[model samples]
Target: MLKDSFGRVATDLRVSLTDRCNLRCSYCMPPEGLQWLPKPELLTADEIMRLVTIGVERLGITEVRYTGGEPLLRRELVEIVQRTAALTPRPQVSLTTNGIGLERLAAPLAEAGLDRVNVSLDTLDRDVFIRLAHRDRLADVLSGLEAAHRAGLAPVKVNTVLMRGVNDHEAAALLRYGMKHGYQQRFIEQMPLDAQHGWKREDMVTADEILAMLGKEFDLTPADPRERGSAPAELFLVDGGPYRVGVIGSVTRPFCGACDRVRLTADGQIRNCLFAREESDLRTALRSGASDEELAERWKAAVRGKRPGHGIDDPTFLQPSRPMSAIGG
Candidate 1:
């Protein structure tokens, strides 16, 4: 396995297919959306495939996750998934989506050999959903979630970002709902990804608060984590059936110790951490006439430079050059 300086294996990769989106989340963007990536600068499906090939072969990557501003916004998403499915080892494929376009593409993506999905749904209440996402499409998102279920995306998980006053109340309810429906509800604390949005540290919802609420209702017995550098969310069954819940304390309680994943953006930059101040511009290398071996050499240098951890817990966070949208979630 490929181990970084943190001793975290680079087994999972989150690739951003595109930075364009259909909905604007309040935390992720300003009222005026950010400028879109230049058409000429974005990685083509073929170029993306070449990188994925390298990631699996060179980085010991076994899990390939497709993320985006909204992945389905890319016209070539199906092609990407298809090509990934055709990879030699057949890496476990997953997608993180906004759920707006999931209804149309879920089953097709599943048939395309996509393994699972992590849908971003911040609130169950319609008004709250609209308020958070700046769009009145809660019903549509819910419908898309149902469509994902119908599409055989078993163990479909919902990723909720907990804003201070926006959706914290929904946390416990989301847990109950997850338990009732066999879905894994993961609550992630907010973190500053870019300076454009002006995200603040005070706005975070800590995992302790989230667990306290669940501890009141159900016993959150810890399950043995499946693998090294798997996930921050300590797995637990919510007292009834096998319904599971995950909690990622990236901000208030950062889990940099076992951080496993690396991000490759739509524009082809390799970021070592979400709160990264620097990135290796793969797009520049690819477009500047670098050979495959040279490209791999550049990648090697970047991987060797991975930090032990972001160390966000120690009184600092990097002002990232890119936003969460550009970070591939």
Candidate 2:
């Protein structure tokens, strides 16, 4: 098992397949998006598979999450999932997508051994969705979620980033929509990961505020906590309801101590934390024909120095140099 200095075992690996996204989310990337990494620089499917194999075989990683500026935009995504699923222990495979492209790809991805999906859907209001995502694809996203559910991706999850005075007003409505469609909604507090570096503490909707907003419409109870796991969301049951909602208070109530995940950008840089200021370049080493053992050692070195916490509440906290799109959500 790969245990960091803080004793947090690394079990989850988030791989960003591409830095190009169709939508320019206000809280994620700049309006102009970004100059994406050249295709030649992006890690190939074989390289990604090799890294996943090493993580699973050597580092005790058991969960492989495919992320991106939008993972669905990656052409080889299903192939990546298929290969990762074929590993010895067969790590649980999942994806986080914007859902605009999911309607066409969900069934194929599910058939390729994807375990589940977390779709980004911040609002059902067309105007709000357009204003936030810089796209008018709310209906497309909704259809994609339904497609994923129909394809047997059980318990499809929705990731809603709540920005104060923006989409926070839709808290109850979003929850109700998820509940109605049998989707588990997870409200995430906007962090300092925006491309513009414009995150303000007062603009973030905290977990407490999210609960309070939902309390206006439903009776919620703390759900029985699952086994201590790497997944970040904290779950809660809607009183008298069949489904539950989750809250990832990344900023206000950071879960740094229990973090067991590491990240790999599309360009093959290993980031120990979402807010990590530094990253180890894995692409150069991989292209240099480094042996699997050597690659595994590189991963270990990165984890050994993982920061204890994100320091979101610290007065001296600084936003990451790269935006969420480049770092992978």
Candidate 3:
């Protein structure tokens, strides 16, 4: 088990296939976009599978989430999901995408053994989406969501980031939209994960505020905490029972104490924490012919050093050098 000094064992792994993204959300990167990793620097499909095999067979990973600047951009993603689902004690495979190409890839990915998906859709309005993502792809995203649902990706999740004075007012409407379409709505508080370092606390829509906004429209009762477990989202039973909504209060109501996630970058570096300033390089070792055992040990070592919390409230906290896109969401 990848047990940290804090006694938290990592069972979930987030793997970034590439740092390239199709959308340039204002919160993630500048309109011009940041420099992407060269093709040569990224891990090959074989390399990625080898590491994933080690994690599942040797390190006790039970859930594998493929992420990226936009995971749908990775050409080999279907193959990756197929391979991951074939592992012994097969992990629950999922993808977090901007939903650009998902309209076409959803059925293929589901057939390839992808268990589910989380699509990021901030607003229902096309104009707001254009202003936020700097792209006119809202139609593609909605179509993708429909495709994923039709492909039998049960409990299709929609991730929304409510920025103050932006799409915050659409909180109730977004939830209604999700409920109407059988999609689970999750509102995540914006964190300081942008490459431009432009995140401001005041500009963020806090969890409390989000709940208050929804409260006015619907009666939200906290779901059984026992069911939440190590999941980042704090779920609420919408309209009494059955249907639900979630809020990931990453900054205001930190869940780091129960965090069970570890990240693998496209370049094959291990990130023990999302906000970590340091990384454990596995790409160099893999390219240099390191044995799987050695690589597993390195991964274990990385998780062993995980900090207790993200420390955003600490005066000394520094935003990670890699943006959310590069960090695999």
Candidate 4:
């Protein structure tokens, strides 16, 4: 196991295949998106597989998650999942997507060996969805969730970002909808990953607020925190309901101490933390004919230098140079 200076073992690797996305969420990016990485600058499917192999075999990464501006946007996604699943001690594979293109790709991805899927659905109302995502594709997202469920992606999770006055009112409804469809619902507190850097604590909804809202609708019992493993979400069971809901309090309640994640940006930068001001460029080394062992060493060095936490509450904390989409949320 690769243990960082803080004694946190690196076990989860999030590979961002591309910095391109189909939707432009107001909080994530501008309505007219920012300049994207040129196609030539992005990592190829083969290169991603090689990195995954090194992370799995050499670095002992046990879980591999494909993230992106939207992961499904990658044409070679299924192939990537297939190759990841074929590893010796095959790491559990999953994806985090916007659900826009998932209707067509969900089944194919499951067939290709993806173990699970997490769809980002902030609201069920068509107008609200459109206003938030800058797209009128609520029906498509609904279909995608259903497709993922039909494809045997059990406990398909829904990631809902709660913006104070925005869609925070939909908390109970979203949880109920997920419960009805057998999706594990996770309410995420909005973070400072917005491209606009307009995140305000006053406008952000918190995990405590979400739980208080849910309390009015259903009974909730705190679950064993140990079951959370390396997941960022804090788990809780809906009192009498069949499923549970989780809250990722990245801002108000930071989980940085237990973070075991290392991200590979689409442009090939290795980020030790999402909010880290600096990144190590692995693309340059890779193109220079660096061996797999050398690449692994770089990865290890990056993790070894992982900071103790993402200082969201610190007065001097600065938003990252890149947005969530570019950094692979």
Candidate 5:
């Protein structure tokens, strides 16, 4: 098991397929975009599978989420999911994507054994979408969401980042839309992960603010806390019934104590924490003919050094050098 000194065992692995994204979301990157990782630097499909196999079989990884600047842009995504699903004691496989091309790939991805998907959609209005994403593909994203639903991706999650003076006013409407479409709406507090390093604490919409906005339109009671487990989102029963919404207060609530996730960069570096400044180089070890056991030990060592928390509230807090795009969501 990948146990850290803090007694947190990592069972969820987030792997970055690429650092290249189609949409230039204002929160994520500049319109010109940062330089993407070179093709040779990216782990091949076989390499990703090998690392995942080691993680699942040796390191107790029960869930694997493929992330990227936009994972839908990966050419081998379907094959990767299919192979991951074939593993012995198969781990749950999912993807975090921008939903750009999902309209065409949803059925194929479902058939390829993708268990679920989390699509990043900040606004329902096309003008706002363009302003946020710098793309005029709102219709495509909506179509992708519908396609995923039709393809049987149950509980299709919609991740919304509430930026003050941006799309924050749409919180209620976004939740209402999710409820109507059967999508699980997750409102996330904007963190210090933008490429431009432009995230301001004052500009972020807090979890409390999000709840207040939603509460005006719907009755929200806390969902069973026990059911939350190691999940980042704190769920709430919408209108006191079957449907629920989630709030990921990463900066405010900080669930690091129960965090079970570790990340692998597109180039195969192990990130014990999202805000970690250092990384363990698994790619070098793998390329140098290190055995699986050696690789696993490297991963374990990395996790053992994880800090107790992200420490964003501390005066000494420093934003990670890599943005959310490079570090995989």
Candidate 6:
């Protein structure tokens, strides 16, 4: 297991399979379609698989999560999951998808050893959905969620980025929908980080306010943060029922101190933080004939420079040049 200067061990790795997505949520990609990573510059399936293997062995990466502009966009996704699942000690394999291609891919993904799905569904109302997603098919997303449930993707988590004027008001409704459908709906703060030039401070809805809104409808109590990843969400149990609500405090609060995740772009650069402009290129090392041990050392060296936190906490901190869709959030 590799340990960083912060004494944090890399237990989880978020791999972006592709830097392409279908949806353009305002908080994520804004109204305009954002710039995309050049196709040739992105990592190929084999290269990503090799890195995953190294991450599991050398970085103490116990869980592998496939993320993307939309992970499903990569045709080799199922195969990638299959390969990662075969590793010794068998890391917990999971994925975060847009759910557009989920209807057709969920079952295949689960059978190949995918353990969970984090579906991005901001609104239940069709008009609101289109306005938020820049797409007209709310039905498609719901169908995909239903299909995921049927495919044995249990505890299916819904990721709703709550913006003040946009989907923030629908918090209770979204939670109700989750409770009825057995989904673990998480309301993420419309953080300063987005695909646009800047994240409006006033546009955000804090975790406390969102919790109050849901507390009005359900008897909510805080629960422990889930697993080894980022605690973007505050987990809560609703009364005595089965479902729960999670709130991500990326904006009002940041959790970079305990952040164990190492994000690998679909191509082969490793980013220490979401807001970091500098990245270490690993694909070059792989292509330049770096051996497994050499590559592992490179991974270790890159991880040591991990900052204690992100600059988002500072008022003068500028948003990264690229948006969420391109960054594989």
**RMSD per prediction, one decimal?**
1.9, 1.2, 0.6, 1.0, 0.7, 1.8
TM, every model: 0.93, 0.97, 0.99, 0.98, 0.99, 0.95
Residue 290 deviation, candidate 5, in Å? 0.6
In order of TM-score, best first, we have: 3, 5, 4, 2, 6, 1
Q: Is candidate 2 or candidate 6 better by lDDT?
A: 2
Quickly count the clashes in candidate 6: 7
| Tens digit of per-residue lDDT, candidate 2, span 227-323 | 3255688877798545778899888777888888999999999998889899999889999999999999988988899888988777888898999
lDDT for model 6, please.
0.82
In candidate 1, what residue range of length 10 has the lowest lDDT sum?
221-230
- Give the winner by lDDT: 3
RMSD of 1: 1.9
In model 6, state the lDDT of residue 326: 59
Q: Please tell me which model should have the higher TM-score, number 2 or number 5.
A: 5
**Candidate 5 C-alpha error for residue 320, in Å:** 0.7
Q: Write the per-residue lDDT of candidate 1 for residues 230-271, one digit (tens) a residue.
A: 576766666743667888887766667777788899989988
Badly placed stretches (over 4 Å) of model 1 are 194-197, 225-229, 314-316
RMSD of 5: 0.7
Candidate 6 lDDT tens digits, 106-214 = 9999999999999999999999988888888789889999999999988799998777777778889998898889898888877655666667777678877888888
Looking at candidate 2, the ten consecutive residues that score lowest on lDDT are 222-231
Ranking 4 against 5 by lDDT, winner = 5
Which whole-number lDDT from 0 to 100 does residue 217 have in model 5?
A: 89
lDDT of 4: 0.89
Question: Model 1: what TM-score?
Answer: 0.93
Query: Where in model 5 is the C-alpha error above 4 Å?
Result: none
lDDT of 1 at 312: 70
